[model samples]
Target: MSLSQQRRFPRRRTSVGASRDFVTGVLIEWQLHSLIEDIELCVSELATNALLHGAPPGREFSVGLHRVEELVRLEVRDSGPGQPVVQCPDDDACSGRGLRLVRALADDFGINDHIVGKTVWLVFKAPAAPAPAPAPLTTPGSS
Candidate 1:
């Protein structure tokens, strides 16, 4: 099965959170509940990072989702400059753990440069199929 969805938002801190919630709702509506939390957090963190570092003023960002075969991908794009450097956030640092968390949760992830800004993508394995309904019980003397 394949599913795809996308949305764009202005580069703003509040928009990042709202976008996460919106995307999470979409995932749940599509019966991809298993991935809702993880993907939500990943998207939020990445978007927040983009807003903080990438978005300058009037730039915008986009989030795209693609379900191909047994894999689902979440991509966030922003109009900021320079690619994000995936580094280990120091213990004493106030921030910089966004990418680290993305790396930990996403099965496979990467950074891509776009004409305007950059896109950070994370791919996850689709959730297991729901078990089949059980057969009705039969009693020896019932029939």
Candidate 2:
């Protein structure tokens, strides 16, 4: 079965931590322990980006989680102009590497530009479902 959940956060700095917590809760509910770390990091980066650069004055952004079969998709949508890009900042630059992390950990990455804003999404390949336990071995003579 497929699963989906989403939340919208304001452009406040605290929203960054809130978004991380939100995603963590959802991942836990879905029993996706193996993916919590990477997904949390990605969500933090995206949410931070949205807060710092994407969210316009008095506007909010959204975070979404979706699972379909073996694939999980994470999305962050912001109502701001211009798309975010990964740039090679100077060594002295203390920031501007979040997208790079998203690119590295995510199995796939892409952005969808809408008329009003853009949605940056990351796709991860979920671990295969555990195989059912083998039927208990039995001897034909055993009643």
Clashes per model (N, Cα, C within 3 A): 0, 0
Where does candidate 1 stray beyond 4 Å?
A: 131-143
C-alpha lDDT (0 to 100) for residue 88 of candidate 2: 81
lDDT of each: 0.86, 0.94
lDDT of 2 by residue, 57-139 (tens): 89999999999998999999999999899888888999988998899999999999999989999999989889999998999
Candidate 1 collision pairs: none
lDDT tens readout by residue for model 1, 15-111? 8788788778778877788899899999989888878888778888888998887788999888889888777877999887888899999999999
Instruction: Please name the candidate that would achieve the greatest lDDT relative to the true structure.
Output: 2
Q: Alpha-carbon error at 133 in model 1, in Å? A: 4.4
Worst 10 residues of 2 by lDDT: 83-92
- Error at 98, model 2, angstroms: 0.8
RMSD of each: 2.5, 1.0
